[model samples]
Target: MSGYLFAILAAAACVAAFAGVYRARAIGAVATTGPLKAHSRPIYHGLNAAIWTAVPAFVVLLLWLAFQNSIIDQFVIGAVPGSETMESSARSLMTSEIRQVAAGNIFRQPTPEVQAAADHLRSLQAVSTYLLVAVTLAIAAIGAFLGMKVVSARYRARHSVETAVTIFMMFSSLVAIIITLGIIGSLVFEAMHFFAKVPVTEFIFGLRWEPQIAIRADQVAGQGAFGVLPVLYGTFLISGIAMLVAVPTGILSAIYLAEYAHPRFRAVVKPLLEILAGVPTVVYGFFAVLTVAPAIRAIGTAIGIPSSPNSALATGLVMGVMIIPFISSLSDDAFSAVPRAMRDGSLALGATKGETIRKVLLPAALPGIIGGVLLALSRAVGETMIVVMAAGLIAKITANPFDAVTTVTVQIVTLLIGDSEFDNPKTLAAFALGLVLFIVTLILNLIALRTVRKYREKY
Candidate 1:
């Protein structure tokens, strides 16, 4: 049976077990009414039984599935002929072929020994599946029996259920932390490999970025530069331009919507403005490439100014438009969160609406506005498609917005594409870029948090 089918059966068994246990508990509670008063509700008893039936069985199933492939492969390798004489790479290839043959996805003629091993693998997998089903169902049955036996009037079913729920929540939170740690660890490991090949200082401070290097000793091309500053410069330049366009326009729009606009108008306008955020970044990229870039170039040329077909100006402008809704929505919420009593008191003190808003509402909302801007800035920095389509991939340090330049994210994407040789610096450089990007973003988040906390405390 398929793993998914097994999962369904396991779930069904748990449900059936829970239903029987709950019915028995409910009947028992009503039958006796003396010093043995029911300590917890029938629902809690049912929930506790369900948790016991499912959790252990699911945990075992997950662990078995995680290690099943590796164990099966090891057994298959031991049985395959000439396996001990094969190199690591050759063994990996053979394993792939065996899996393909076993699954009936074979693309090439297999030797008799390989075919025999494949058949054996299929048999092993079938037996393993049967064992998994039996074991999981047995566990669920045992847990359900124990749970039902313990469901007396004095049993703390609510406490047990609540404890299980608390543990599950903690596990869920830990998963996120584990995933973040895994990402950082992977990046640092691969980045260390990259730095072993290229100097860290050169990668950080050098002004050029050309990661393509000759693979063969006889090749004529020299080792390409791995400088990161030019890419960082381009990222900052474009993001700065985007912030310039997004911040004022979004804040003003938010101010109008939150403070001045009629409720009916706000209802109509807010969703319309937020629609920009829902539009895919790729769509913004296409707009920039097909329309904005061309228009900018033509206008620049007509005015006797130089402009690239794919320039920072085009990408930044489109990115700014894309980020506007994020800023506007967040800022609107921030502005709306200010106390109405404060607004009323300011007006009662003879201050004009505009003056009250400027002196009172803006100050109160500044932290949230700053937070929204920071978030918008992060979105602009991490953006890939819009920059890739509208900004040409040339790593150069220049202040001119009309010039073509590339970002760190674009470079990371380029370096990782179709390059499987992790031993090479060219592929590993992607991790180096990723690490730097993560650090920069972390710093931004820290600053934003600190600023928000300070203002929040003062307010």
Candidate 2:
């Protein structure tokens, strides 16, 4: 039903645009008898009319759709017998069941009262949808009439259309800002709840990271430690190892592709390299678990170094291989963006090819390369599936790459598994960890932006 509303809106906008052009053309025909003409093109007038026809009614339709479900739930739940006396959770469950029945998802027999309530709910929804369609179409008609009234010989339809488009673009850009704020707000909100139960100092500075607490208020359980250092160290350790593996390799490959390889070879190699990014992270995890981890363990045993089967080394190496394309693709573009004249001038000044690439080309492309590296670093920090599959569940501060360690994301997943009661510190800790991760990623992004702005070379 809601889908049909979108179709109707689109059809109405198209019709309004055509009708507006027709009206403008008619006005032009009348004006040909005098020394008057349209101030704007017929297309501009049509676009303005389409905006007028769609915007107001679309806004109303969205508001109606957003609130209609909750409003219907309130009315329908009241019709359910004993709903008034049920606890909030029970009432919510009953409401869900009623909705399921109304949506034709019932798999078992419903009680007579529930069946009756479902019927009533369906009836109300049908009436509401019909009313919505009528009101929306009526508002659209009124808007079309208003728009057509302004379409005359000397109307500034172009200005009106431009203003409307500018506002739409501004809103489109604001959507990202709005989403960022919403994410930060949600993390902070839930994190504050966690902090209320556990001290911020303890969570941030304490060394242990056990996160066990009572699942229910009446149950007694051990008060778990909320130290984040172990996971933080593990995150950095794995990311550091990944950077070690990825940076030199990725940058070298980028340099080769951009400066050394023939054009045909570069084209073939770059696409094959980028194909790594398209390979799913789960496949990388599987590779780490089945292939990489075992090889590392075998090598460790042969060399007298004890290593866990799920070592950080294995995880980091596979993660590095996974992000190789992200770095190579970006770095290749960056190196290629350095003007050809710069390289030619270096050669003309009696510099070797290696020296030109090393000193001149690298410095010119440094900003973009740094930006790519940092973004890849950010990617490494946020990865979870590979960590979950290959890294240990145990969180411990360790310097050894061969040690089994966990990350913030892995810990968050561990703590939030199954049906978690968010009131407990055990579950709430995940939000705090998430807040920490979010801050780290945000910092990386800020640094990348600053670096790009500070030294970005323009050719």
Candidate 3:
């Protein structure tokens, strides 16, 4: 029914737009032959009418939808016998049952009063929807009339439309900012709970990464180690290995596609390369577990290297493959953003193509390339599934890529898995890890932004 209201509102807006256009055209018809016609175009007047007709109706519909269910639940509970004495939680559960029954999802026999309450709930909803439709349509019609009435030869509809657009853009940006703050606030709040029990220094600088807390006094683990260093070390090691594999290949491919490939070939190959990015991380995880892990283990065994079944090398390599498009696509855009004049002038100076690319184009695009690498590095750092499947679950300080090591993301998931008491450090530890990861990503983004500013300066 809400969707139907949207469709109706849209249709009314279209009709209103046409009416406004007709009214404006009629008003300006006499002045067309004169020096000054309408101050704003008929299209702007039409848009103004559409906005007036849709916005109030949309707002009313949203408010109605948001509040109607709660109102219904309150009224129905009050009307139902024996509901008044129930606890708040009981009332909530009863509300759920009533809604399920009203929605035709009844699993068992209901009392006569419940059946009647369901009927009452349905009837109220129907009446509310009908009233909503009537009220909104009336408002829209009045708005359309007012909008068209204002459409005179001297009216400034274009200014009004531009102001509305600017306001909308500001609102969108405000919403994004609020949501970002909310996420960071939540991470910090939960992380505070973690730090209350465990000292900050122990969590941050300690070398061990065992997060399991003993449930009983006699448990050999006692208070399990909460050191985050091993986890941080593994994360950086995997990310470092991934960056090593990704950087050269991605940048080279970008250079090839941007500078050397035929247009048609570039179009085809670039999309194919980007297709790798579209592949799910879980799918990559499966590929790592089934294919890459075994291959690495075989190579290690043949070369007299001791390799774990689940090795960081396999996870890092696959993760590198996954993020190739991030670097490649961004690098391509960066190279394309570089002035063709620079390339042409370098060639004019008798520099070879290779020399021109190395000395001229590469330097020009370096900032953007760095920005892309940093973004990709952040992406590689945050990835969970690939590392979860390919890399071993043990968090320990290790330099060998073939040795099993777990990352911060993996630890977060492991710590939070199954039933966990929120007050316990084991569960709270996830939030601490999350806060660290969030800070890392934030720093990366800031660096990326700084590089972008530098790139803009060059252009």
Clash total of candidate 1: 0
For each candidate, the alpha-carbon lDDT, in order, equals: 0.88, 0.90, 0.90
What is candidate 2's lDDT per residue for 321-377, written digit by digit as tens? 988887888899999888889999999999999999888988789887887798789
Q: By TM-score, how accurate is candidate 3? A: 0.88
Off by over 4 Å in 3: 33-36, 71-91, 101-127, 213-223, 415-423, 449-457
Q: Write the per-residue lDDT of candidate 3 for residues 158-260, one digit (tens) a residue.
A: 9999998999999899999999999999999999999999999999899987777787989987688889889988999999899998999999999999999
Worst 10 residues of 3 by lDDT: 450-459
Report the CA-based lDDT of candidate 3 relative to the real structure: 0.90
Cα shift from native, residue 344, model 1 (Å):
2.4
Q: Pick the candidate with the highest TM-score.
A: 1
lDDT of 3 at 117: 89
TM-score of 1: 0.93
Error of model 3, residue 86, in angstroms: 7.1
For 36-118, candidate 1 gives per-residue lDDT tens digits of: 67777777777777777778888888899989999999999989878999999999999999999999997889999989999
Residue 405 CA error for candidate 2 (Å)? 1.2
| Higher-TM-score candidate of 1 and 2 | 1
